[model samples]
Target: MPTISRQGTDFIYQQVTRFISGQISSGVLQPGDRLPSLRRLSDRLSISVPTVRQAYVELERQGRVESRPQSGFYVRARARNALMKPAPCRDCKPAPVRCRSLIDRVYEGIHRPGVLPFGIANPSMAKPAAKGLNRAMKRVMARAEERSIGYAPSDGEPSLRRQIAYRYLELGGAVEPEEVIITNGGQEALSLALMAVAREGDVIAVETPTYHGALELIESLGMLALEIETCPEEGLMLSSLRSAIDRHDIKVCLFASALNNPLGSATPDEHRQELVALLEAHDIPLIEDDVYGDLRFDGTRPSPARFYSEKGLVLTVGSFSKTVAPGYRVGWLLPGRYEERVRTLKRALSCSCGLLQQMTLTEYLASGEYDRHIRALRPVLEQNAERMTGLIGRHFPGETKVSRPKGGSVLWLELPRKVDGGHLFGQALDENISICPGMLYSPSRRYRNFIRLSFGHPWSDRIEAGLETLGQLVSGH
Candidate 1:
């Protein structure tokens, strides 16, 4: 037992927390190991039982341990098998996207009725803001009447644009309402940003295990995607990016530097600054996908990479699809120096988004209900993440590696090499359980033995059973 310092500035509970954390770090206490009882630990450490209990409670809040009804606190088996190694990007050359068939199959599985959806990455569905949004829409209809149903401007509603600008301002980023252009969703924002910067046959740099939708968009535009090595924990590796930039005639780099889609890795702000400086120095544009920026478990909203840009080469994409209402299809883009070009593309493509959805979102943001819903929603997602990770650790193969997300609502699993993710997806679908095969996430089909599972839905016994069945399938194969 470590002796607690009485005269030190640190509180006794904090000291206890550190000691317990150190034990866990050093493998003195393994996952699922029962912690010492509060009374027992207090007696051993010569401290009050309340102090020890406080430490245990703090640990529980951190997702390090859980307390049972009739049992004491125990370490959570959340991520004993964490993905530490970066996924390999061996032939990091520019190639035309060719994973469309697998992506089509994955989408088919995701939309199948009565199937457990583990394929989609829809986070807001975990704790839907339906009531608040409906109320906001009702208020919009009552106020605007017939105008609510009319088409919004090509650049979106003014009130929603100002609200977005205010949010960026709150995060210490100077974004003018005029600079914000609303779109159909983040997908359209990405498409507009891509079109604004690069043209057909242009080579776009993307993360190795990138989002499937980005690949689809690149294919449709007749562009080639060059894979850049991405760390499962830290996101796009700067060194690998520098190497790719040196070797390829990269026109534009599209990345989810804030919070990645499948891996849920968040790049440090300092790293993002270096990334921005690196690209700006070369005069190459960076389109940052920040749709999942506000869903971090810690509630710390990372400043947009555009905030670090000195040459105005960074374009930011954000949306309410992942956070608020996906079906509403309201998203925005801060198009840096290419604002006029993006506006033109938006006008040519979708013209304008739904006026009612824009007005409802504007009301949602203005009335303080959006922030309240976000605060309430984050904890539920975090809890769901913990539960899903723990269950995966319990049921998956011993060699399985999973990404422990910092936020968002999905788990990326690297199963045994013999297990084919595509085959597993088919098998899971036969059982009426939908899962996303890893091949869809990459243009090169590198993640053949991997899969991404969504924990975005409300937790239930059905989900638990589906996970268990999925585990059994993996074990049998």
Candidate 2:
């Protein structure tokens, strides 16, 4: 997990605070939405009851949520003053003593006059698809009388799930309609997957330079991580994975088979097939993150982990947030073996998706509108990634080595050891660049010299100017 600081408060309390804040920001905990009981939260996140209570006390103090005595805690209606961001402590938390993610560093580097950032993965939204999507949402709203008011299904609408399953085929993964479970987003899908398969203190094998978000999830669940080094060209290094497996007992290995976070490398078909075989031979399960499966800019889509093993050993996670209307927060997972367990977890959490969202997406996907939108999106993403890479080459220091991913919107950069990006974060914030640092991705807290750059957002003149500014900073360094 990205090394986060404790605010002199206990760890559980701190985690509870951040959890509520994100839920509030995302509207998941709608205005007046009742929060789960302290006992419930304690059991859920596996913290002490008192720890959950302390966190709630802080939330109430800030008016972010309310306590109604006998009834329970309810989400307080706080006016979002964009200025009101949650502070971790009296001071903004800096990088930990050891860096965790290079994605974090790219964000820091962008704020300076130097430091060209080839970090953070974000898709550009200024394209025919985005414009078309805006129109599509408006069109859907035009029939609000016929839409909007219906309550949504708890396990997601049948139609939407089917459509989502169909989209999987376009990407080369065979997903049956019954196998799909719609979620609030990829995060929810992942959380459900974790809850379904793992218990407290279970060991989950993760890629060496993994996504920090996944690492955070593992830590939150009181789990230990076994890191496996992956190659730049071949993606995950299975030889090391096999060695780790033989040496230690593990619960599951979570990986991105297509374009992974930060690194943006695609695991080849042979390696992917090998991964499935290795896991099956070892009787280990895998959580395959294919969120960026549809964003490939060139060549055939890489095969999902599902191809080799159809059962519970491989659960393929997907999300429309990156591809379609991000704000819709629609995502799904094809849990081959753990299907029932994952569904049960989803029901416990939020009880399925909004009816209107499901309907809109179902219509979009079934009508073949989704494929056309993706077809339009891919080229722009390719162009943007190429453009950013060119900029980094011309601007960043010569010691940096950047990943040339075939698809996806993120570029992972390997910087010189002379740079400890965690140290440079405060300075970057001063310049207002707002990029995600690189150290947030690793579990062992190394990788202080890497960064993740987002090439997925709209490539406008302003963004281009920001890139130039980022380039100049790296050149100056």
Q: Write the per-residue lDDT of candidate 1 for residues 18-126, one digit (tens) a residue.
A: 9999997776775556789999999999999999999999999998888855557877665568897788786778989987788889889889999999999999999
Candidate 2 scores a C-alpha RMSD against the true structure in Å of: 23.8
Residue 171, model 1: lDDT of 96
lDDT of 2 by residue, 297-372 (tens): 6535777778789445898888887777667888888888887888788888897687677777776776678878
Best by lDDT: 1
C-alpha lDDT values of all predictions = 0.90, 0.69
Model 1 reaches what TM-score against the true structure? 0.88
Output the lDDT of residue 39, model 2: 87
Question: Could you tell me how far off, in angstroms, the CA of residue 18 lies in candidate 1 after the best superposition?
Answer: 16
* RMSD of model 1 against the true structure: 5.8
Q: Estimate each model's TM-score.
A: 0.88, 0.73
Give candidate 1 misplaced runs (Cα > 4 Å): 1-50, 53-75
